[model samples]
Target: MPTVTPKTAGPDMSSPKTQILAALRRASWISGQALADAAGISRAAIWKHIHALRREGYTIQASSGRGYRLEHAPDHLSPEGVHAGLQTELLGRNLICRRSIDSTQNLAKSLGRQGAPEGTAVLAENQTQGRGRRGRSWASIPHGVAVSLILRPKTSPDKAPHFPLLAGTALARAVSRVCGIWPGLKWPNDLLISGRKVIGILAELEAEMDRISAIYLGIGLNINAEAEDIPPDLASVATSLRIQAGRKIDRLDLVRALLEELEAAYYAYRLQGFGPIREAWKEHNITLGRQVRISSGREIITGTAVDINEDGALRVRTEEQELVTVSAGDVQLCPAV
Candidate 1:
């Protein structure tokens, strides 16, 4: 794994509730007095903080004599939850958590326009109007990870199209670290396991004439959904981490890993160049060296995926022995006849 020197400590953790939660995680049980002393507050204030944590879905058990025990933490994505173990410099430093939202991407874009910092992140538990590539609707349910990151990279506008590939590579690395299963990447912005889509990424760019202003990278990952949670129409083509791993996954861990990996990848691209990312993406991609059919506008071209160029264009070797570079399209792996 690549590493970057962190400019600042990840996520803010000065809140009383966050402090109490940290204490609960450190020991089996903590006395109210002890928590208050640790948090520099009175026992009554500690009780109030504990009550707030419980309302936020933390399963805290209180004994007659013993103080409190954190029995379970909900799988939902929260700022405190993700910040507890997040290790990153730029990404996810200014985090926002919402229970329900129209879309994380929209909010992130709005923040970007208002001069939000480079590492600002917006995470939503449920996205009512999520979107995917080609104007398709992306469904986000509870327990899934729906996040949008605001990145202001110092690069040209031509390089904006490759942001999705960079994000996909980072996500693949994070998933492999968490679930022990390495997912294959489809061209553009999809992660597949057992030939079913599990992750989708969309990159929207705000650019000037020559320089790129900001890139809002939106990612939707299906973490703990069951088979019934998937729509009937997409059941055959989609899956969740729980279905693939046969157990529930911790969303906070996945989110932290993702932010760390993304920070590393993004800085690598900015400082070193795209050589490392392109190679890493190729190692995990299922598109190259396969027979694929690309639908670009009115033309459907069937060919062997030869390579992806530096600008992230897919080069296809067609039946006519002509090599064509496609900038954007829908790719499908063609079965051998």
Candidate 2:
């Protein structure tokens, strides 16, 4: 049996508590009978949902004759909150939220194998074994955002590597919009806030020869964690939105913004190709004009980061003035000589 996870907020629009919360968000008195009629449930069922909402940190006022009114709602990310603010055509149409999970990518891949539709997403508050590029483990705090989006693109397998770069571009835009500070991208999929990493994107896919089956694009974003919350080894390099912005952020709002931007970028990539995404990427990228070191397995290359090709490969000008196109590598910015 799968572990039972608790949900502080969720995307299930049909839950009675979710419906009650939605109605209560209007800040007006809603009678029990009216709620029951709207929700298509009995008065007792509404009371049960009211109790559930209270447990979820909703301040609701209930009286024998006056009915119920919402005093305040918690800022937790819930299915109702995500749905209420969502403005996308496809992405996040089917969402699953978990309080704790091993990894949203694994869950999303399983769902994809089971014929889950394109734009299906899985979100988790805590990832026990979140993964990063090159099979490294990702550290996800309770305040972090870990989500995986499932897609079935008609593009060939050669375009697989560009997915994460597209995601990074979308993430940078979303983070900038929500935090009021523009984030810079480091090569393919890392977003840096104030020269420290705050977001990591990982994309995995299944394909047959040249045909593609599905892609699971995952993101781990540090939202509200502070410096001390990060491990000592990463304390200096890892930072969160709360740390960088000096204020707590609303995760639900950020999630909605991120999904909207991601959906728009994904659609544009499918319809208009990578031209728009590539330009936007270069605009937000910090690596293009810097001296850099790239590690590709046993070989290490030191050069000046020059450009990115149409296929999303990084172009590096070596000391010998030779232009090398790197498909994938661990890129590190070096001080100018």
lDDT of each: 0.87, 0.84
Clashing pairs in 1: none
**Considering every candidate listed, which one attains the maximal TM-score?**
1
**TM-score of each model, in listed order:** 0.90, 0.87
lDDT of 2 by residue, 1-337 (tens): 1111222233333566556666676548889888887667898889888888788888889888888988876766677667654667678868898888999999999999999999899988899999999999998865888999998999899999889888988888788889888899999889997789999999998998988899899999899997778888988778999998989988887998888888878877877788888988998999998999999999999999999999999999999999999999999988666
Model 1 C-alpha lDDT per residue in residues 1-337, reported as the tens digit of each score: 2556545472243465766777788899999988897677898898788788899899999986998999999877777777664677778878999989999999999999999999999998899999999889998854798999999999899998779999989999999999889899999899999899999999998899999999999999999899988888889889998899888888888998899989988988888777778888998999998999999999999999999998998999999989999999999987656
Instruction: Specify the poorest-scoring 10-residue window by lDDT in model 1.
Output: 5-14
Which residue pairs in model 2 clash with each other? 9-78, 10-78, 10-79, 10-80, 11-79
Query: What is the alpha-carbon RMSD of candidate 2 to the true structure?
Result: 6.0
lDDT of model 1 at position 214: 94
